[model samples]
Target: MDVVVLIGRILFALLFLGSGFGHLTQTDAMAAYTASKGVPAAKAGVLVSGVMLIVGGLSVLLGVWADLGSLILLVFVLPAAFLMHAFWKESDAQAKQGEMVHFNKDVALGGAALMLFAFFAHNSDLGLTITGPLFHLG
Candidate 1:
């Protein structure tokens, strides 16, 4: 379990860090890309990217508030994968035709890792509220 957690942490963390840095350092390109995808500019794209990197990377590495981090990553990645990538239009030949293909894959993988980490780590001495169900009824 510890090893699994560690591996998951590393995998998830690297992805978050890479993504965040890419978006932050390439703000002009990223913003242009986002606008191309119909996302509004004037919103601080670089700031948001930086935040995603810091928050997501830290949470995964420290395993603190990882669930929240995972959830956030999940939210960010899904539409990024489908909407931004146009996944349905891709064939094997065209799949690797653009940067969006890779970005889409990376985001999707990060989202999946986040979800798994959240689910598995839930059993690792973490506080989870169980409501409306009882193993023992008196």
Candidate 2:
């Protein structure tokens, strides 16, 4: 792999790993935030977020089954970004705009991570296999 790509992978993995660890360590805050968003059973939010962070972050780091991990993150982030952040009209005037922007940026990052999984799908070494060939340059 090119040095740049390697660096990119490491950087991306680190971001997710750091975020995951943060989520694990700050479960109480996350749960409160989830409740503020009206998520059902806010107490469960901590466990859910922690698992997503740990599993998804690890997959990205190991470069194995990362696509699935990215997909999982995609599912989680899109809803949280939209519903919780209320990037639409639900935001309050005082700080709603800032929150919306932040959530939107997170959504973009999640998308980039998903795309990275596609770009590096060929590097699986953790017994996670795709069913078909990934390229068609011929």
Clash count for candidate 1 is 0
lDDT of 1: 0.62
- lDDT of model 1, residue 132: 17
Query: Candidate 2's residue-wise lDDT over 7-119, tens digit each?
Result: 66567667767777777888788878878877887767667766786776666556556666666666667776776677565546767777778788778977886676565
The most accurate candidate by TM-score is 2
RMSD of each: 6.3, 4.5
- The clash count of every prediction, one per candidate, is 0, 0
Best by lDDT: 2
Candidates in order, TM-scores: namely 0.67, 0.75
lDDT at residue 138 of model 1 (Cα atoms): 31
Instruction: Please identify model 2 stretches exceeding 4 Å from their true place.
Output: 89-91, 122-138
